[model samples]
Target: MRTRAKLSLSLTVVAMVLGFMVTLQYRQTLLARVSDVTASYTDGRQKELADKVAQLERVNKDALKRLQNLNGEIAAYEKESAGADAQLTSIQQNLSRYRILAGTTPVEGPGISVTLMDGQYNGVGSVSDYTTHDWEVNYVINELFTAGAEAVSINNYRVVANSGIFCIGPVITVNNHRLVAPFQIQAIGDPAVLKGALEMQGGILDLLRNVEDIKVSAVKVEQNIQMPAFTAAVTAPPSEGAAQSTKSSEGKQG
Candidate 1:
């Protein structure tokens, strides 16, 4: 009976030790599983944060590129605006110059003045031969233009591209206004060239001097010759037939 009790006590002690080992092993397995889950969660969180950072970086780079493009566009617009301003200023200056040349604006400069007078009627020839005609006035004006006269006036009347000189009876009309003897002509140009052109052999001045009934004189050079602006209403263009009739009338009058 003692042998049987000793064997039973030994079996009980062995069973208790086995139980303690099993519990320790189970706790260790549970702790390992928890650590693995925690590691996976931390890894996932880090990956998500990294992806968000990369996305923000891309967005920021795109925004910077767009901002740079906008700056370039603004600079180009400013440059274009500056060029347009310069062109506009140049155009305005040219317009002002053209207006002066068109006689729309009054002008003053150094120039020459010509005086023409009718000789005393000696009763030696026809009345027309002793008087100045519109053709003669037109000829003198044409010569002045050929000599590079920038501006011209007949008896204070501005002579523009469409100015006309005609005769009414014995009186000569310039710009549709009656102008009597001693017709004064003012021209703006190089004084030396103008004087030389008028005084040249067989020139307008010389031809007038040769005529027994016409007297010609020139100022040669005069400073500060002011020219008034053209003030007459523009005449409409004449039809072909009307132009022919007018030419025929002028010829007969001449």
Candidate 2:
């Protein structure tokens, strides 16, 4: 009986020890897993913060660069403005002198109204000898200048020496300016001379009618046309007035 009791006690003790060892091992494993998770979370958070800081730095750098560029641009614009104002003052004084010198800008009186429409003459195949709007305008302007026109305008767009005429599809531009036709050309000169140069009864009119069958109209009228004076750039100084003023000052001193 005694031996059996001791054997039962030893068995209980062995079971308890086995249970304790198992609990300790489980606790260590759980602690290791929790530690790994905490480290990973901390690492992820740190990386996120670092990336945000880097992005902010980049944005700040870009903003600073933009601000510097804008400041530089503002300084340049102010300098340019000052120079332009000085130039403008110098120009206004000179223009006053030119107006006096020209006595009067050219005025339109008793001029002919010449209309040159698009040419349409087909020779062979489907190809027609139709003149484009450009050709007609060019030919008319050239003919007008040859015909001694002081000034000319097409569709009220002034045809100056430095005028720009460009074509985009069916539309035509004058002075980088667009307009729709039929083109109205106003030439300020002797109507008789212009008419003679264009369609002198048996000149270009007869030739166009017989050769190409193109139509051109020239009619004489007593009328007035005036072209606006171009805005002058500030380079050429006032010649006569300044000289006169200087001479008058000299005379006064004498």
Q: Which candidate gets the maximum TM-score versus the true structure?
A: 1
Off by over 4 Å in 2: 1-108, 119-131, 164-179, 205-213, 228-254
Q: What are the lDDT scores of the predictions, listed in order?
A: 0.69, 0.58
**Candidate 2: lDDT over CA atoms?**
0.58
Please give the lDDT score for candidate 1. Answer: 0.69
lDDT of 1 by residue, 204-246 (tens): 8878778644777765588879876664444444667987888
Error of 1 at 139 (Å): 1.5
Q: For residues 86-122, could you state the per-residue lDDT of candidate 2 as single tens digits?
A: 7765765555445423322223455666655545533
TM-score of each: 0.51, 0.38
Q: Which ten residues in a row have the lowest lDDT in candidate 2?
A: 122-131
